[model samples]
Target: MKISNQNKTLDLTYPQVMGILNVTPDSFSDGGRFNHIDAALKQARAMIRDGATIIDIGGESTRPGAAQVSEEQEIARVIPIIEAIRLESDVWISIDTSKPQVMKRAVAAGADLINDVRALTVDGALDVAAQAGVPVCIMHMQGQPQDMQDNPQYCDVIDEVADFLNERIAQCIKAGIKRENIVLDPGFGFGKTMAHNFRLINQFNRFLDFKLPVLAGLSRKSMFDHLLSLKVDERLASSLTGALLCAQQGAHILRVHDVKETADMLKIMNTVASATH
Candidate 1:
């Protein structure tokens, strides 16, 4: 499978890693690390060098209890970095925002995909994504970041997520977004409990029922913290384990922080699978 826009094309026949670049001051992990333009460029280069085919740049922290950033502030935080990277690299750039204005400007600045945690539910988001003509990743989040995890309840998490994504896919199509231009994320940590995350990953293939690409983002997430009592920085081992597990379960893209490590794991898994075949 592949995700493509006018300026970029990402091959997903084999699992790919999307390096996370948060240009926010308070993301749960790696916040305030690359808020500067040069710093963001440097990190982008490192991830590309580390085998990241996609660089997902987020201007707002969507961590639970995270404050919302205005569209102007978000565009200011991310556009310059997008332009700078495009001047030097053609790597797939994913604008990670739900605001329509931010989405419009980021794509104009050279973003190739829209990765919205809200699944385009924000007013004007669907129209902007449909008009931008880039691949859109619709993630499932039950509530706003401020209260999503306060008490996320689901009679059946996988089924509920699948139902939500399916509905979003239908909406996108109705809005004129091409089927090939849509991707699905189950929103591993957005509104899920630790057990909910595990079940989602295990039954991940069910999401492919839409026949769209599925993105799994479990890198250094709170799920590991809750399950293993490990802090964010100390979750690399657990994170890589989750990546490998997701890939084995047919995840098309793995949004991650440890790019090189996850890339290495995918290499080994691919090699062994090829040998077996």
Candidate 2:
């Protein structure tokens, strides 16, 4: 599928890496590392140099039990970085936010996509995305970020998530956004137990029923931490493996912190896969 974004069609058949740039002090993975405008722009340029096709800029910490960031704070944290990156590079930019206000202003600052963890379910979010006319990633989170991780359950995790994405895509189309401008994410860590997350990650390919682009964000999640029994710094290998599996399962985008390695690995893997086919 070709995802329409920023007046261009994004090639979604081959998987690409979206380097994560969190301009927050408390993201679950790499927080405070890129909060400064210069630092964030440097990281974005480096990711693009390493073959990152998209740079995902996030201000709020969606980590479990984290307090919500006000719209003012969110915009303050992201707008400068978005502006700085646009001036320094031409890589696609995705504002990782759920607030309609932030989404609106970030696009004005030159963001090409909206990577909302709430999947545009927040109030006025649909209107902001529809008006901006950029691709919006709709992820399936079980509940609010504050308490999503506590006692999460689903009758059938994959099917439930897939159904939720299908409905959200249809909702976007009805709201005047084109289908080609929508991407679906299974929301790996948003509100699931390790087992549930694994179940979804292991079988995410089944979500192809929607036929829209899929973004897999399993980079450095708690599932890898739990399985590897490693500290946050030691999960790089596992993260790469998960990224590879996500690509093999039809993920068009692998959102990650380790962009250089993921890009190199995808190159080798793609070459081998093509040879076999």
The models' CA-based lDDT, in order, is: 0.94, 0.90
The per-residue C-alpha lDDT of model 2 at residue 229 equals 89
lDDT by residue (tens digit), candidate 1, 1-277: 8888876678889998899999999999999999999999999999999999999999999999999988899999999999999999988999999999999999999999999999999999999999999999999998999999988999999989988988999999999899998999999988888999999878888987887899999999999989899999999999999889889988999999999999999999999989965
lDDT tens digits, residue span 183-241, model 2: 88999988889999889878988987677888999888888778878888888898898
State the displacement of the C-alpha of residue 175, model 1, in Å, after optimal TM-score superposition.
0.5
Off by over 4 Å in 2: none
Q: Which predicted model would earn the best TM-score?
A: 1
| RMSD from true fold, candidate 2 | 1.2
Per-prediction tally of clashes? 0, 0
The lowest-lDDT stretch of 10 consecutive residues in candidate 1 is 2-11
The candidate that achieves the highest lDDT relative to the unseen native structure: 1
Per-residue lDDT for 183 in model 1? 93
In the order shown, what is each candidate's alpha-carbon RMSD?
Answer: 0.9, 1.2
